[model samples]
Target: MATLNSDYLIIGNSAAGVTAAETIRAKDPYGTITLISREPHHVYGRPLISYLIEGKTTLDAMKFKPETFYEDHKITALLGDEFEALTLDPEAHEVGLKNGDSIGYGRCLLATGSVPFTPPIKGLQGKSNVFTFITLDDAEQAWAAAVEASLKASESGRCSRVVVIGSGLIGLKAAEALSHHLDEISVLELADRILPTVLDPEGSALLQRLLEPHGITCYPGLTADEVLGEGDQAVGVRLTNGECLDCDLIIAAVGVRPNSSLALEAGAQSGRGLIVDERLLTSLPDVYAAGDVVQVCDVLDGSEHPLALWPNAMHQGKIAGRQMAGDETALFHGSFAVNAVDFFDISLLTAGVINPREDMGCEIDIYAEDNSYAKFVKQDGKLIGYILLNRPQNAGIYTALIENGVDLDSLDQDIFLETPQNLDFDNEMRWERLHKFYPRDLDRRGWKEKI
Candidate 1:
């Protein structure tokens, strides 16, 4: 096998891995850094793939970093290659590639991201018209196939139909994009509401209504038992409620499961994701994990959950890279889920635990109107969580307060009604927000028992 030597080998080329490489270059200017990915394209925002299908942006515009990013950082990129195994041992610490080659590393970071969770529905795979809206290639193929399907209906003057399974962020974004391309777009969610992971039922309902004008219909509380097809082509989707909807194309946006088995098989600690301590190290020596593949402290209830958002991945990657470069003080400040998405003009921002259990002793305040909705959640008089829609201007301040535990007792009720000004915050909080790192765990209250 051909052997490639490196001081740092990062598996995956998106946010976490790339950020890690950048951070490493700052510390060790002469060390060799190798970043690999299954995709051939340069790193781009995964979330923007849906917008590419919707015709809002071109593939070139999707590039998050310039082409010179790797060259400028003095990093070697192994794109369009799949990682097969970790050949770390006494003799050589390296990663095996799908091809007959291995890239040896002094320290390896596993930032391999998640893959789409394919639901257990019959006749879903091997269908030419079926696709997952996750990667850039997935978006390109889905859009090309959808255009071909549209040409078939040119004589009939009817719109091609697109069914997006799951009403989470991926599903809604796909539906929104396909609505502009096809005649009909329907979102089928197994849950009763959309964005169940982000927004509560009330916020979800508002989003559903806002999406109606975009020519997209959402069917909640529906599960797909089978994907009906005709001779290797997807024709319709069969739901558990005894209804079959015609579909020219289907985009599976159910959810994503962490790609942690590689580390687990290599004998690393893992649960829903690769488990890590404050140092972000795995069970094995000289091996660390970051990004969507690793579980992080939620800090809300002192639980570990996959904060798969891009920002968290970038932050974790920086910390992991610093730690790998010999910074023992690089401890994780903790993370929770935070998502902000705009669909056809209706902007939604959800941070932390939106709906805390009643037994958790959280105070809830809601403001809902025709086009705006905001829900604030607090524990011990400090902001803990919030969900805002249509009104996203001052959303950052609210999120800062949640992470830093700003006492809500001082703020007037008008904080929710308008964009909160800097004067609204105490001088200390304002200074930290503008100058220093916002302290996430400086508060006195301890972790309470989960109800």
Candidate 2:
């Protein structure tokens, strides 16, 4: 096997990988950087896959960065199945590929995101018209299948339908994307409500109401028992309650698990996910892991788990890159969950511990009027979580409060009663935030609080 060497080697090519490559180049312009990606395409916004199927965005428009990004950064990208990292030899500092080629690196980063977790259900094996929503290719194939199914159903004078298992963000988004082509879309979630992980019961109900008008129906507290099929193609699904719903397509959006096997086999420590320190260094020497592959510290609950959120991955990539480039000060200070998404015409923004455990002794306040709803969760007089639906104005203020653990008593205005603003903070905090690195010797009262 031929071997190539690089100063820095990064695996995966999504948000975290791309960001780390850019950061490394910015810090060390002369280092040889080699990025390996199993994906054939250039780096694009993974979140935009549904938009691509919805016709809201084109393939070219989905590119997260400019087309010449790799060339401009002078970084080598080994993409497609040929360059897939099959093995990691920590002692040898090399990664083996399927194509009988290996890459030796001085320092390596594993940003190998996550993979969809498909549960064991009868008739799922060797089935046609069944898919998972994750990669761009998945979206493309699903869109094509939807078009074919719709055409066949239209010719037969029947409504085209799709049954999606799991009503989390991925499943719901898949339903929304296929709604335009199919006559009906049903989301089956075993949980009691949609978006169970991101929203509270009330918020999930509100979003479900919004979704119904768009021909997307959610079935909570129900799951598919078996995928009923006809000649290798899925014709319908039998629910756990013994009801059968016919569908032209089946989308399994169950969940995702970190792709940490490569690092684990190479002797990296793990607990739920690959364990990395504050600097993103794994147990293996000269090896680091970031993004969804590593379990990171959650500032809210003081627990370590894989945060698959995109922004968190980007932040981890930056810290990992900086640390790899010999900058000791660059560190990851932990993260809290946050999600902002829009469905049809309505928008939802949530942050932190929206669903605190009953034993945690957190206080919650909720306000609802018509289509707008706001809920805040606090612990020890500090903001920790919030849900804003249709009342998204200045929602970042709440997020900042949660991230920084700002004390409610320190503010002069009531954050819950009105929309929060910068002026809500006292004069000293206002200056410290507005000009974060401004001279500390300057007058603290210069920026007067208007509110």
Candidate 3:
């Protein structure tokens, strides 16, 4: 095996890993940086895979950065199966790859992200025409399958149909994209409401209404008990209620679990996800973890879990990169659940704790008119969470309030009664909030000053 060395080694080539590499390059221009990924392609937006399937974007146009990204940053990229990381020896500050190569590093960032959690349904294994929506490759394969199914349905004089198992963000997005090509798309969600983690019951109902008109039907409170198959090909699904539904394609979007096996094997501490401190450092020295692979404190609830959101991953990666470059002041401020997604014409922007336990004494406010719906959740008179559907005005102001933990009592008007704006707060408070948000927008020096 050949031995390679680098000043900084970043595993995973998606959002978090790429952001960390960029941050490190900006701070330490001369450092030898290396990035590795199991994916063969260049960096692209994982969330845009559905868009790619919808024909809204091409494969080339989905690139997150230019083709010359690695060369421009002077970073070495080892991608695809040839460089798949198999082992992490934190004691020796080295990683073993499947290609019989070993890499030594001064500092390492594990941004391995998450893996799809496929439930153990009968006849689901080794099945054709069943896919998961995560990687760019998965999107391509599923898109091709949809095209084939449509052609076959046309010959049989029947409408093309697909069954998506899971009504969360991934499953619905997959349904939306496939709906454009197929005649019908059915979403099977085990939860009573769709987007269970991101939206409340009312918000979910409002969104489901919009999806129904676009040839997408959501079956809540039910899931696939078995994937009925014929010769290793999934033909239908048997629901827990014993109802059978035919499908040309089966997309398993149940959810994803943190991809922390390598870190755990290397003796890193974990609680559901890899545990990292303020500097994003793992239990092992000189080994940091970020992105979906690491658990982070949720500012709203103060609970630690792997935040799989893209923005949080980027923020964590930037902080980890700074710390690895010797800037200890780069600290994580924790994050809450924030997401913005659209299905057809229906748009949703949500943040923080949309659902609170009854024991938390949270004050809830909701407004629904026509197709628009807004819900606010507050605890101790502080805005903690909100869901905005089809009404996207002043969403940043709401997010700012939740992130900064601004007291509602400080404002002169009820933010729920009217649309929130910067003028809602006093001039001094407005300036303070704006300054904090843009401190690092100029240069890296500004980051230290703010922190």
Regarding lDDT, does 1 or 2 come out ahead?
2
Worst 10 residues of 3 by lDDT: 442-451
Clashes of each: 0, 0, 0
Question: For model 2, what is the C-alpha lDDT against the true structure?
Answer: 0.91
Off by over 4 Å in 2: 437-451
lDDT of each: 0.84, 0.91, 0.91
lDDT of 2 by residue, 252-367 (tens): 99999999989988889999789988889999999988899989788998888899989988999999999998898999888988988887878889998999999889999999
* Candidate 3 residue runs with Cα over 4 Å from true position: 431-451
Q: How do the residues 358-390 of candidate 3 rate in per-residue lDDT, one tens digit apiece?
A: 988999888889999999998998999999999
The model with the greater TM-score, 2 or 3, is: 2
Error of 1 at 248 (Å): 0.5
lDDT value, residue 46 of candidate 1: 84
Q: What is the lDDT, from 0 to 100, of the residue 429 in candidate 1?
A: 62
Residue-wise C-alpha lDDT for candidate 1, range 377-398, written one tens digit per residue? 8888888888999889878888
Poorest lDDT segment (10 consecutive residues) of candidate 2: 442-451
Candidate 3: C-alpha lDDT? 0.91
